[model samples]
Target: MCGIVTAVASQDVVPVLIEGLRKLEYRGYDSAGLAVLNGGLRRVRSTGRVAELAEAAAEVHAPVGIAHTRWATHGAPSERNAHPHVSGGLAVVHNGIIENFESIRARLSAAGYVFESETDTEAIAHLIQSKLREAGSLFEAVRLATAELTGAYAIGVLHETEPECAVVARRGSPLLLGIGEHGVYAASDTAALLQVTRNIVYLEDGDIAELTREDVRITDSAGQPVERATHVSSLSADAVELGIYRHYMQKEIFEQPQALANTLEIIGGGGLPIPQLFGADGPAVLGGVRQVLILACGTSYHSGLVARYWLESIAGIPCTVEIASEYRYRSSVPDPATLVIAISQSGETADTLAALKHATLLGMTRTLAICNVPESAIVREAALRFITRAGPEIGVASTKAFTTQLAALAVLTLTLARMSGHIAEDVEARHLAGLRHLPVAVQKVLELEPQIEQWAQRFAMKHHALFLGRGRHWPIAMEGALKLKEISYIHAEAYAAGELKHGPLALVDEDMPVIAVAPADELLEKLKSNLQEVRARGGELYVFADAGSEIPETDGVHILHMPEHYGMLSPVLHVIPLQLLSYHAALVKGTDVDKPRNLAKSVTVE
Candidate 1:
């Protein structure tokens, strides 16, 4: 959840550190800080935005520095809890939790080391400083200190004594080394370092790196030297910029069409779905998959829920979807014939990765990953993977990532259905045609943003909302509700239309606005009855209807017609207006649309 950037350069690096923090703002931070070695250690921290920290550090400049944007974990968001925690001559910025910090704190406290802030990172700084007497250099001290710590962490350490070098270590959190002409840098994400370098070295789980202006040295956990290949990054600096959009959320919402097209580009030539689309061993793995168990968290979990409907209906396979965090703790029946699928936008999701490992522990080896990042931990762990080309989604509330995930899952569904001999050639052709036309459909749906924004203006005034859908679209409704609550700060919930009269009908009133996904599918009449139930209760309605749904706008019911009914792929299109609605509602309310409260883009900690 936190961000770390460190550099050892021939020139002053304070401005570079601040700029890197600005690029990492999407990771959702409450405090920003930086420490540099300019003859002595100089540190500045702020509990506000990075710009505030930059303003405060305007006079400080150095050739070696480390910076951090922190999302609160061990303590409250305050200047005292900000990173670049210093002890002795060392300053540290950490990205993940230290599980055994209490013990380490007690030990360090017994040695008469005072803790300035209530943070796990301060313990790390003290621990590294304590090792300075026994270790030869700052890198050695950091490596020794990390051996005693137990938990996920990607830490950057700077020592005033070693003015020309910075040390960084990673275990369970992401960290990368960047090679630039004038400097060597390290960051938790490539976006933070893209301004300085295009060449990157992705460190392994226990790798420790020492960066200097001239070169970088790497060592494994056991102290042996190692070599890591540097790859040229495909991401451009302009890709992360919010071009004409007011916020990154709005920009990502509009980018969904291209994102989906890129994800589904494999089958653009119009052919039967093949297993190799997943990976080289996809054929061997898909052949033995008689049942499916999908594991994911957040929006990715909802995608799995949607996939359950597809797998059972089209592929004729029994499917179950589980929340990854919960599934990892509880015991469950594991079948050898079951395929375990893990879905995540960033495959580094802590819970999802743990759940995948848990599944492997249970002897379920038929693993697959549907993720956006190709080099993520989950993708590397799984036997098969389908990487969605959603590019980099900077917003905390997912838009393009969700749609790209659905596009990838659709391809997975068709492949399995074909393997099971459950699809006719003509039926496959029709589905392929729908997928080929999906980008156009998504663009047409984006055209309804103006109408959705008008609806959002009304929603901004309301505090509660209820979303309704049926069948596969039920998951889409859940995703919509999630988006609204994520960015707008509105309390929202979703229900399968059939479950309305069971208990949710009692909550429907004039104060609560009910939104419905009214696609003209087989369940249209049943969903129409559910809408009528809301109308009977004086609940104001906002319905997104298909073009031919014939759901007319009356006194209490507001209808925004979608461009078309996209058959099995309707969820991909139905979700766009909901995303726009959330973006506009957050905009109207003046909330931070990209970095919502108490949320992080990539959850690296449990």
Candidate 2:
């Protein structure tokens, strides 16, 4: 993933570009660079953070400029490989990969064009420079270059000959235009342009945009003019603010209750879900569905795994979950009656979008999206959408987004149950009551943090961890293990409690810490025996037990009891302490909880 911010303004725009890049640091980057068409072209590149790039370009200022923070793809992170790659009269900053760059590079080389860095992007800059003379306009040159390239890209181009204009294009990657009274801006996401304007126009896949100080013009791929509607954004600047918490991850961990409340706000009216919760024909779609298929990645995939349990057990529907990246590339049978749901926090995940498109192209059109951003590509592409109100999760590891997604999926389950005539009025009322009281249940779970922190202190020194659960909580165990490895740098793995006897038991020892999610569900007795399996092998056990689970702390076994057990909703409640544990473990180990190494907030490129 990479970040871009370009502006055509009457005032000096270097500060604005730097600030935009600063706001996008959560997306993850290794190098930062910027180019401005002041007199000719002034550019600076750094292999460090955005602050280093700002310090390097302190003396350079211009009315028109483009900046980029790059997460490496084609080459190592270095100043030479940074963006705003310049050749001849053109400078360009690009996000996403140019898959056929090697062939293009060879052809350009035969034509006497030289490359500065070993990057797929430098070839694009050279190609644009080569076409500028033939295409007549900067926008036309970009369009021509795009025709020759393959794969995803969102690029911002600067021309030395045209000092007042900035040209940008998008294909398979996200790009947006910001309309402001003082200037116009383009970026990879709205976070970069939010400070200047609330009004935005999201570009289609093959759209090209030209920006100047006073106006912006957009054209489709065929060189015909197109009009795009601009909408005002509801995201306030304060949603991304870290007021009292040490890091964004910690802040989001505590904001779970509020986020869940916002996601379930419509159901707080005390009735079954309306058809509009999904779409105008939601009830009909639910009634006609023969099966459920979930497409997602990362934490969202785990959430889908959890939803499989709910959809199958509560709604009596057969469910399947697939990793988005692999699903698109594999040959699979498509059932038209299957409800295909795409889950993503950013709604711009490249793999998930591609998978959804692939499924739709195969005639499986009953699609739905569970997303957080209303303006994201997945939301626009799906036939129906449910937007979670977990606003602006800045952490690389997801917390609030995952919980809010579960809350939305719970509503989806109830909706399907009602549509299938499986639940009566009183049963539906009880489920709604349990959902409305989720915030309070999560609050009680948060009360176990001090005790979990004690467990985390002991876990901080361990090198390996095993997470165990049974039935519906198995996915929760996987999520807990993922959080620990993602933030604390611990080697962690999860298995269904029954699978321990097959092969995982060999890894259990005094040094290997075993964490168990033990709810008071029917499987509690079986899970207790599994914990004894670990305890017999001298593995220290840390169990998150419900109040009536009868699990107690002794010698090598440690227990933190919950005040109550929430049936079918225990995953949402139990995940809270696991999040707290991961945060505290990362804190004790002195690791960066927000920007974990080798990870980005959104995986926008494949």
Candidate 3:
């Protein structure tokens, strides 16, 4: 993923673009560059963080600019690979990969276009310049240039001759217009443009935004300027502010209740019920008839795993979740009836977008997306959408968004069950009742702060940890381990209790804190047997358990009793302790929490 910011203003745009890049640094930090349209074309680029780029550009003065913080996709991270790739006085910062870059590069070479950086971004500037060679405006040239690319991209083009305008387009990456004082700003992350403008417009795929010093005119794929509505960005300055919180992970952990509540509000227990995958209704929605194939990267992939469970168990539909980076390069045969569900908080996740487009090319239509942000590239391709209400998760360890995704998916599960007739009256009533109680239960878990704070001491010295779960608790285990490793940077792994004998029993030493999810479900007896196995191995167990499950307190097993058994809701409660553990672990270790090293809040550049 990469970060892009384009600004056109009467006053200097260098400082504005620099600040935007700093805010959007999480998208990518491998390299950074800025190009400004002054009386002449002045460009600064470096193979480092945004700060390095700013340092390199310290003396340059420019009026309008386009900048990029790149996460390498087509080439290695080098000065030659940094963005603001220029050609014939045209500068551009691009997000997304051009699958046809090799072909385009060859064509341009034949056409005598000299290249500088070895990036897919360069070809666009060359092509735009070539188009401008004809009798077209800069916006027309950019439009023509972007149309030829055979892959996902959000590009911002600035020309020396056209100093007061920036032209941008998108296919499968996010791009936004930040309406500022007598000027316009554009960036891949709202964080970058937050200081410049709170009133923003998110650009859709195949949509073009021609930004001028005076105003921004946006248009559809067919060249008609459309009505540009303003989205008042709600991201609080404090939300992103680390403040007194030692790390973002800790801040986000405490924000879980509100985050989950926001997502619940979006899905709304009152919304139209979700339809089943398919059966008698002949697929009410196209996505219902289609097989469900999910694509995501990292933590979002974990969330997808939980979604698969909800979809199959609750909605009576089969589902598959795949890692995006691997799935993007595979030769696969997904059924034509399949629907691809692409999950990413930022919507600019490169590998996920590639996989989603690949599925579409293979004729797998009816895509549905569950994401947090509107106007992200992931939203454009989906036939149906559910925007997770988790606001601007800044932590690398993803506490709030993961919980909110579960909340949204759970609501969706109930909806699909209702639509497909799989939901019996008693079952539906019970599920709804359970869901209704979820918020209060989560609030209760939130109150266990004193207890959790005390428990954090156990992890301050541990180097390795294991998370255990059975059945649906399996995903919770995986999530727990992820939170620990992500923030604490501890070596952690999740294991299904049944797999203990298959392997992994060798590492269960006394020092290891084996966090287990032992809910008071039907699996309680089976899970109790598994915990016995861990006890036999001399493992120190930290269990978040229901009151029904007998607390095994022999030598090392200690239990943190939950409010009650939530059945499916247990996963939510089970997560609270894990979050606290990570928060405290990171706190003791003295690692940066809010902005974890090598991690950004949004992966907007792919």
Candidate 4:
């Protein structure tokens, strides 16, 4: 939920570390602070953004520095609770909750350790100072300080006594080292590190690193040297470039076509032209699994919800989608006959990692991940991982990841459907052919941006929106409504087309805009009847349908006839229009599309 950036350079490093933290600000933070080893020890902290903290440190220039952006876990977000806490000679910044902090604090207080802040991170700096005073080196002090600490944590320390090097460690939270030509940099996520260097060393659990300008060394608690491998981030340097779009969210909204296309190629590329990203193991597992359980949080959870519909409809298998935070709390049945699929964008979400761990502890037949980050904690746990190739999404409200996940899930659905005899040989071939065409279909929907812009104007004036669909498309409706409420700051609701009469009918009126996913399928007549119910009640409508669906020519209905159907994969293509609708509507209302109020990009807090 927070960002940590550190550097040991021959030149001033405070400015660079603070800039990297700004790039990671979209992850959400409440306060900022930095510790610099100048002529003497200097620390600046504030209950505001990185820029505010930088203003307070304008006079300090240090060659070695470490900074923190806090999300306020242990205490209220105040200057006192901000990170980069210091003892007499040791300064530390930390991520993740320290479960046993109070007990350790009580013990230290009796021994004459005085604390200046109410933060759990402050205790660690004092602990390190006490340990080093007792004849311990920097590494040994960190090891001893971490010995009694419980729960998830990642810590970075800079000592005034030893100003040449910075020490870092991770047990549960995420951290990576960016090895650059001039010096080294470290941060909580790949974004902060990518600005300086693409070659990164991902620190796994129980791993620690001691970084200096001359060399980078990593070791375990047992003192055995460990090899640090370099993995490129999921995004390229060009990915962050918004190009011609007005905002990051707008750029990602249009990039979905190429992103989904990239995902389909990666997932479907066995021996095909598109480079094979998923290994032989992915197809093998999908061909053999008897049962499946999916886990995720927030937007990823909604994707899982949509995936369940496709799995049951196309694969003819029973699938359950569970929220990651609650999955670990339940006693679930798992055996060698079951398959667990965990989805995450960052791959370091605490709840998702805990749930994935719980599933493995019960001995699931096989564990897998569909993640964007290749070296994330969840990906490390998966026996096999199918990476979603959607580039970096800087917008706090996700746009590309959601669509790419749907595209990947669609591939998984069809591949399993062929093996289970739910689809015939020729039908499977046809579906695979449609997967290849998904990119173009999504592009066609994106080209209708002007039409969506017009619709957004009408939607911007309304206070509420309703999304309706039937059968497999119900989840799409739910996801569509969620996108609007998430970023557009509009009251939106989704309901099954058949359930419109049960309760939602009361809300129907001329000012209310109802979005209907009316595809040209066997259920077309029933869906048309459902639209008539809305029309009879004087509700305005914006309908997305496959060509030849024979949409009713109602006066208030605005219909966008989509390209040809892609079978069960059609929903993936169909959702593009709804997302664009929400994006444009939010932009029209002058709301913050990238960082919506009260919503964090990564739900790392809970």
TM-score of each: 0.98, 0.98, 0.85, 0.92
Kindly report which residue stretches of model 3 are placed more than 4 angstroms away from their true locations once superposed: 46-61, 74-80, 106-116, 135-137, 217-239, 266-283, 286-295, 311-319, 322-341, 350-367, 424-427, 449-463, 511-513, 594-606
lDDT of 1 by residue, 265-365 (tens): 88867684465488778888888688999999999999888888888888888999999989988879998788999999989899999899899989999
Full-model lDDT for every candidate:
0.92, 0.91, 0.77, 0.82
Q: Rank candidates, lDDT, best first.
A: 1, 2, 4, 3
What are the per-residue Cα lDDT tens digits for candidate 2 across 1-606? Answer: 789999999899999899899888888889999999988998899998899999999999899999999998899999999998999768999999999999999999999998889899999999998898899999999989888989999999999999999999999888899998789999887878788898999899899999999999999888899999998988777777799989999899889989999999887666766665887867666668889999999899999999999999888889999999999898899999999999999998999999999999989889999999998899999988999989889898999999999999999988888788767878778788899999888988888888888889987989999999898899999999999999999999999999999999999999999999999999999998999999999999999999899988899998889879999899999888889999999999999888788788879888
TM-score of 4: 0.92
Report the alpha-carbon TM-score of model 3 versus the true structure.
0.85
Rate residue 579 of model 4 by lDDT. 81
* lDDT by residue (tens digit), candidate 3, 83-195: 88888778888887788988888999899998877788888888888899673788888777777888878888888787778888887777778898859989887888877
The residue pairs found clashing in candidate 4 are none
**Candidate 2: worst 10 consecutive residues by lDDT?**
267-276
lDDT by residue (1-606, candidate 4, tens digit) is 888899988889888888888877777788899998977788998887778887988887998999988887788889888989988878899988888889889889988999877878887888888889664688778877887688777899998878888999988888889898778878887777666778888897888888899688898866679998887665666677668988788888788877877777654534232124445565555556787899998778878888898888778888899999999897877766667989998888889988998898888748878887778888889877778878778787677898788877777777667667687767667767777777788787788878878888887868899999887788788888988998888999999999999999899998789999988777789989999999999999899988888786568988888867666777777778888888888888889787676666665545
